[model samples]
Target: MSAYAYYPGCSLTGLGKPYDESVRAVFAHLGLGLEEIPDWNCCGATSYMSISGDKAVALAARNLALAEPMGLEIVAPCAACYLVLSKAQHTISGYPEIAARVHKGLQAAGLAYAGRAVIRHPLDVLVNTVGLDAIAAKVIRPLTGCRVAPYYGCQIVRPYSGFDDPLRPQTMDRLLEALGARVVEYPLKAHCCGGSLMGTMEDIGVRMSFLLLKEARARTANMVATACPLCQYNLEAYQGQMRRAYGEDVTIPIVYFTQLMGLAFGLAPKALGIQRNLVTADPLPVTV
Candidate 1:
């Protein structure tokens, strides 16, 4: 009915700024609106989940409670935030003890949680709510020869995400096809991108990302399109790490799906934050 309450999470605001821009740009091009939820706090990502489930849910609860006033669905672009927020909602709703504790925690900040906030991913909103045919009509330039590998990573549709089938997600594949790009059949679409494990376990993470890039390249995918910032970072930033692991080079530009949408809409590359990426997305030719 109205603009979504945008939640940037830590990654989107810090490391994933381009994603945030492109998501806004594509939404604007599609004639949709997104209003950032004011004074939003962290969803605690995966870090707090291991230490304390209650505190992490409380952190996520605060953001959900804040969105109550806006009365709009919360669109979280980062996959980790999406999962954590969804988990928080489930945890709060399923457990009366958790609900009571989180409610008390929110009350201390002049806030309350009635579980009114509806959390959604940008992909879910764009493809489901906005519709691909509607998006296709807005494309000023079609990605004629661009071969894209749709990587859903491990979080977006996992556990609680209801928008798409988690194991065999086709939302991105279908959306990219609408943009005129060949969607590479990626077997590792839902595979783990090593996520924070890349930081904590270095080589293991690099090798995992290396597999995704290798597969995309093997399938003749010129670039990898993903909805998660951490997936983009791990895949794009770590191609140089495990060169020995791959018999052949596995370097490919990993980009947000929204950037491709912007290109199809004739939006500027700079505006989509293409230059912000470590691996130059120079090969994705856009005919304006």
Candidate 2:
């Protein structure tokens, strides 16, 4: 079994707790092991970069430094964390001056980052490392009748399109199909879910989320499967507000892809934190 250095960013500890639980449960069910990086810090996500690019790279580099000694590729479940870490790696290697500043920051903290550690999202690990056939083999309860809309939500594919197509990603679609789900045609799969704007710019955020949810519903999808914590939270938690804004009850259970994987793996709902979601919906019926 291959092991990865796991990095669960801030959201996973709080609003995305269910995602954290399901990711762990699903990976364990698949015989994959994850080791949390020791003393790892924040990835300085979207906000930090806008304020100060150098400090943002430095902040993300610290976590990379912590994981370098382990020699395992860092697998982040959070989209923001994955994007930030990947961007930091790219920036440090591409520019000499920025790399020097990042190195100095690490030195001040008595750590050294060689920019050698690989960063990946859990989706990348599952599809590329774990393999779809292996995942399909473990599906004890096929999601036969479930119509799912795979929502990638902007970050994982873009600015770094190595693992999947930037505009039209099929990784999640293919994975869900392997698990026996009826994957729907979701044009807004890679669209923005407004990120932190849901808190600051409520109208714009609600509208963005509503459009995705509305599109999924229009396609007759029962649930929206997401790989990003913020996407899951924004889509699921803001449904009531979205209804008030849009005058339509656009509420569907926005779930983590890992959570669905756990269900398909025959893990109990509690183990996958399925009941923890704010948007309550009947659990997807599993085929025995």
Candidate 3:
């Protein structure tokens, strides 16, 4: 069993609680130990990067600082959390001046920013470290009948580049395949799910979410499996809003890929966070 530093971010406790729970369960099943960073703070995500680059890096650095002394690699499940934290680590490690400033910020909190700890996303740890074969071996309820739309959102795979194959990511699809789920090569899988649009502009967010939902349904997918917590929340929570706003009937369930993985491990749906989904339909498609 491999032990790694875990950072759940803010949304995990709120909108992404299910995702958090599912991830923890799945990782445990795979014999991975996740130690949460004590006194961790938000990664500042997209908004912080736009508002103040240094501050954003500092905030993420604070989390990294907590993990460094412990000599453990940081692993995050949320795509946004993973991206910001990894990107921040990349920035500080590459620039001495920025590293110094980030260190100073951590110092205020009685910490030091030592940019040596490896920062990884949950998918990376699962696919690369644990190996898809391990995940396959643990599956007791294979998703043979389910046709999943593997959504990557935007942050986890892109711009960072080396995390996964950006042009055509296979990590999620491969993981799903290992669990007996059929993959639908969604053309818009990498498209933006209008992240953060919910708080800024409700109308545009509804439309954006509707477009994604409609695309998933058009492809005849059972449900959308996402690596991003924000995407899952937006797609699931706003399905009704999308239908009402567009005057079209839409009922697509949105779920975290980790949750689906947990289900394949024969864990109960409620334990995997399926009960909270807005679409009230079984996400797993019955195989014919």
Candidate 4:
């Protein structure tokens, strides 16, 4: 099988390095090919888009333009990157007025935009393209006792519900079950994890993060399985702040979904970047 053009986004190189490591590890283990696209730029992130739509699309479209020549689909692991790339693709394909401006911007940089690049979230690829039974067959260390709250955050499914349900996503839930883990019925799975909201407004953002993190714990999940780097960071790194603001200690292990999959595949914790997690679930392999 051909490898997908991997776009690590900017966040994946920073606090989200574990996510990068685990995603690479798991995909490699599953025999999926991941070619990191050369000279890939930022997807303009959320903040940049808010400041300037034209410039933001121009910024994000460059990555798509680069990937087009590669003749492979772009697999964006970061939620913001996935959304922005998807939006950029849509803008260039559907909005002619903006597309002309974006094309002009790309030409100045010695690149071109054709709207042919396809952007995908890795989870969608693994669960939808790879198939669950195939993943189950590779599991050497099943997550039998792992009760995971599959957090989807507000991006991914929203604005583009092509992969799963917008309101009630079940991709991660089913994928976790396939790995021999029990899925907690997390109602706010699609809710915002405050993302950069915590950075600008401490109280409101922390409150949002605290409530969602608290809900997962309240529902009896021992850990959270997230796809977005920002969600993982906001939910995991701010536990202490959340405790202070919410007056409840709802701290629990927060991890990338790929990390748990790596665990089930019998990959070592270090290989999956499990040691990089702030909260420790330190779980034994579940037998289902």
Highest lDDT: which candidate?
A: 2
lDDT, candidate 1, at 262: 91
Write the residue-wise lDDT of candidate 1 on 165-283 in tens digits: 87998999999999989988898999998999999998889888888888888999999998998998888877878676656688788889999999888899988988788887766
TM-score of 1: 0.97
Clashing residue pairs found in predicted model 4: 144-286, 144-287, 144-288
Measured by C-alpha RMSD in angstroms, how accurate is candidate 1? 1.4
Task: Give a tens-digit lDDT track for model 2, residues 176-280.
Answer: 998889999999999999999999999999999999999999999999999988999899989999999989998798889998899888899899888898876
Better of 1 and 3 by TM-score: 1
Better of 2 and 3 by TM-score: 2
What lDDT score is found at residue 111 in candidate 1?
A: 91
- Which regions in candidate 2 have their CA more than 4 angstroms from the true location? 286-288
Cand. 1 Cα-lDDT: 0.88
Error of 3 at 172 (Å): 0.4
TM-scores of the candidates in the order shown: 0.97, 0.97, 0.94, 0.97
As a whole number from 0 to 100, the lDDT of residue 43 in candidate 4 is: 83
**How many clashes does each candidate structure show, in the order listed?**
0, 0, 0, 3
Quick one: best TM-score, which candidate?
2
- Give the CA lDDT, 0 to 100, for residue 249 in model 1: 80
